[model samples]
Target: MAASGISFRVAQAVGVGGALWLSGNIAALSLISIPALVRSQTEDSVPTSILSRQWKYTFEAGKSQNPPIAVATATSFCYLAWSVRAGTQLGRLVPRNSIALYCIAAILTIGIVPFTIIAMTPTNSRLIAIAEQKRDAGGSVKPNDEPVEVLMKKWMFLNGIRSFLPLLAGATALVAVLG
Candidate 1:
């Protein structure tokens, strides 16, 4: 019993910490990074080379940052799952909100990967393709498929939604802790 209690507390700490880290990262990407990137570019059709470089840099930066976020998300999900299971086993001993918190946190943390696949992956692929083409062509290849501005706008909009989910998850986890 004492061991179980200790593990539960450790899980709670890891879950909340990971959630908070993910939330901050998402918020920065949405509110600062994307916006800055958008602002740096023009609304008019820009040179393919310039846009390609920007896209490549952005994508690379995101790739670099993704591992830590992925780890945090996975860690949070694992701990939240443990808590949910443990709370369920405790039955009446666990408060309803506490159980709900575990459930909500688990769902949101796990949901991000699927959400990215469905919502963001298509655009990301398109952008990556365009970036590669531009890189290979030595900056002369302009994407005839879509305007750079349009793609960036779409990416930013979807990313805003992406950012919101983690923030909400973190907030929920914090509330769960307080409750």
Candidate 2:
């Protein structure tokens, strides 16, 4: 019983930490990176060239960071899942809100990957294609196929939503711990 309690506490800590980490990363991307890109687009540098360069760097950074984020999120989800199962088995020993918190955290943490796939992947692909085209053409391409600014705005909006999920999850989980 004590062991189970310890496990629950550890899981809650790790899960909250992971959720916060994800939230912070998304917030940074939305607040810092996207805004910087938008500002860069307005500069004297050709918009396509600035976008292409930024996008390439962003893609590379994402590729490098993705694995660790995935691992941390997966770990958090697994622990939260275990907590849910244990809470169910323990019945009255665990607060109902605690179980709900674990479930919410698990769902939100796990959901991010699929959300990215469904919500963000298409826009990302389109942006990457445009960036690549611009780069290949030696920054001469106009990105004439689509409105780059509109796409960037849309991406930023979606990213704000993405950032919110983990933030909510982390906050809920923290409340569960304190309450």
Candidate 3:
């Protein structure tokens, strides 16, 4: 019984550690994206100057790289947390559905919104490149596709959602922890 208690406590620690690591990674992603978000928010259109062009490319490159890293962090964190819980006495004490709910909430409020923004942002080379590829494939130079206003609007809306999600998740996590 004593050994079981020790194991359970260790497992709980692992779960909490996973949560902490995930949270930290999310925070880091948010910080990394902040400048790009600001640039997107402030600029009316993609810039034309050399420096602005360089910055835009830099931002795009960063956006592409950040999402995969962030997703990996979230996946590893969730896997660790879930695995730890599965081994614990609390696994029996806490309803499985409740754990599922927590995981869903975590993924929704933490993993999805922010990552989606990074993935979809106009300055993200992947999105722009895809747009370009489609345009080139269609063999059109007309401004009919990916208008600046449309891209800006989409980026703004998604980034706004991404900006607010971390706050929501933090509050939810606090409630879960305190209650």
Candidate 1 achieves a global lDDT of 0.67
Worst 10 residues of 1 by lDDT: 84-93
* Predicted structure 3: lDDT: 0.47
For all predictions, the C-alpha RMSD in Å is 3.4, 2.9, 7.1
Would you list the rank order by lDDT, best first?
Answer: 2, 1, 3
lDDT of 2 by residue, 52-168 (tens): 668667756865775477457647656655565553654455566666776676677667678888999988888777777634555466645666667777787887898888788
Q: TM-score, each model? A: 0.77, 0.81, 0.45
In the range 1-179, model 3's lDDT, one tens digit per residue, is 57755754454344344444544544443455444634663575433232234444544664575455445434533543364376565466555454554455356445554576556543454335534433344444334345443444455455555645434544443343333
Error in Å for residue 175 of model 3? 3.3
Q: How does model 2 fare in lDDT? A: 0.71
Better of 2 and 3 by lDDT: 2
Supply the TM-score for candidate 1: 0.77
